[model samples]
Target chain A: SLSTSAASESDADELQKEQQARSVLRENFLRCLLSAASKNVQFNMYEKVKMEAKFGACDIDVLNFQVSDLHTPIGVQKEALIRSQDVISFTFEI
Target chain B: MEGGWPLLGPLQWVRYVKKQVKVKVGRNEEVRGWLFTVDPVSASMVLVDFMESEGTLVQVVMGHAVEEVQVLKEPDRKIADRLQSMFLPPRTSILDP
Candidate 1:
């Protein structure tokens, strides 16, 4: 029982450390997202699909990206919601 | 999202912050920049590449798409300070005499 308690205590400590790291990292990321607002961003998606749009916002869960003036090969869309699952990466100048 | 890089925990992810890294994404994409931060929730990485006379370019590589990550260089004290201050609100000190 002593060894079990010790293990549990260490697990708790590890969890706390992980949570602290997560919070700090998430805070900086949120700030980066905020700074990227209104900037021209290029989104690289699957299937070799690439498009440029004005950076708008990403949901808290990062499930989707809300962009403005999305430029597609066919035509330009005034607004668009891109599912995060389809995106490989995105770039913007700050 | 379910495998590969996503399996890495916060501690491992935090180790890459503030270091210059080269990230391999998808099949044919390679990105390099100063590792700013990684979103623990989505595992996305925020990278900043400073361009001469132009501006800073920020790239966010989705966690699910990361195939590999290589630490290229470590930031010096000055570069670290710059990276940390990039998005921070300017500090206004109050003098207490």
Candidate 2:
């Protein structure tokens, strides 16, 4: 019984540690996103496509980015939603 | 790295924070910067690159596009402090009476 209780205690400890790490990571990430708002961002997409847009907000799920003045090859879109799946990476100056 | 990257979970991802990393994205692109944070939900990585000029560059690599991540170097105290305060709001200073 003592051994079983100790095991359970360790499991709870591990869970708590994991939760703390998750929260820290998430908070920093959210802050990063907040700082990125309104900055000019360059997006690297699939098929060697590179474009720039005014950084907007991203959905909670990180599925879509709401951008403005999206520069496509043909022309610029005043407003656009770029799916996260189509993007490889993006950069912005801070 | 590879398919297991997104599944590395929070604990594993946290280990990479404050370290300089070289991340391989897509087929051939590589990015190098200080590891800021990794979104647990989406597994996206935020990297900060200090430039010669005053401003810094921030790069966000989507989770699904990551091919490999290599730890290049660990941060010293100064760098760690810089990374911690990079996105933080400026704190008010206390006045001496």
Candidate 3:
């Protein structure tokens, strides 16, 4: 019984770690992709991200943001896409 | 900021996106490209494998367009299709901001 309890605790901890890792991965992935997508701009990288996904059917989101003329900042307000069991996400602030 | 491809009407948007959106394009950027199935309301830009007609996809945002449109004509459609499958099993890595 003690061994079973210890194993359960370990499993719980492992699950928590996995969830946190996934969250971190999401944050890191967005930052890199957005940094590259926005390129050189004054895009204030907001920490809030709206995300969604699915295993089938492709979802698309399009927008026209007027950030600036000379320094056009490609600010991705929010994005989510899922098709073919994969996901495409984006997030930024204007 | 830079202007976006208004895509004009939905029909026009469809027609232009049938192929692949031209990348590195800027204002007045007019190149035939495929509109990704990003969302119900918005459209994402991507390159579809011509052979499979359903495979690997590279989501190229409109903002990625810089100045001169860079259109690559010779990507092995077969390989492109196979490689695109790697992007499937949708999972939101980044929460939308």
Order candidates by DockQ, high to low. 2, 1, 3
Residue ranges of candidate 1 with Cα displaced over 4 Å: A1-6, B1-3, B91-97
What's the TM-score of chain A alone for every prediction? 0.89, 0.99, 0.39
lDDT of 3 by residue, B2-90 (tens): 23433332333333333344544433434343333222123334433333454233343432332333334433565434333333333
Task: Report the error of model 1 at residue A3, Å.
Answer: 5.1
Looking at candidate 1, what TM-score does chain B attain?
A: 0.85
Best by DockQ: 2
lDDT of 3 by residue, A34-84 (tens): 333432222211232223221111222233322222221343333322222
Model 1 lDDT per residue over A1-94, tens place: 9999999999999999999999999999998888888999999999999999998999999999999999987889999999999999999987
lDDT of each: 0.89, 0.93, 0.34
Q: Which sections of candidate 3 miss by over 4 Å? A: A1-94, B1-4, B25-40, B49-55, B60-97
- Regions of candidate 2 where Cα sits further than 4 Å from its true position: B92-97
Separate DockQ for every predicted complex: 0.85, 0.95, 0.04
**Model 2: how far residue A68 lies from native, Å:** 0.5
- Least well predicted 10-residue stretch by lDDT in candidate 2 chain B: B88-97
TM-scores of the candidates in the order shown: 0.90, 0.95, 0.27
Q: 1 or 2, which is superior by DockQ?
A: 2
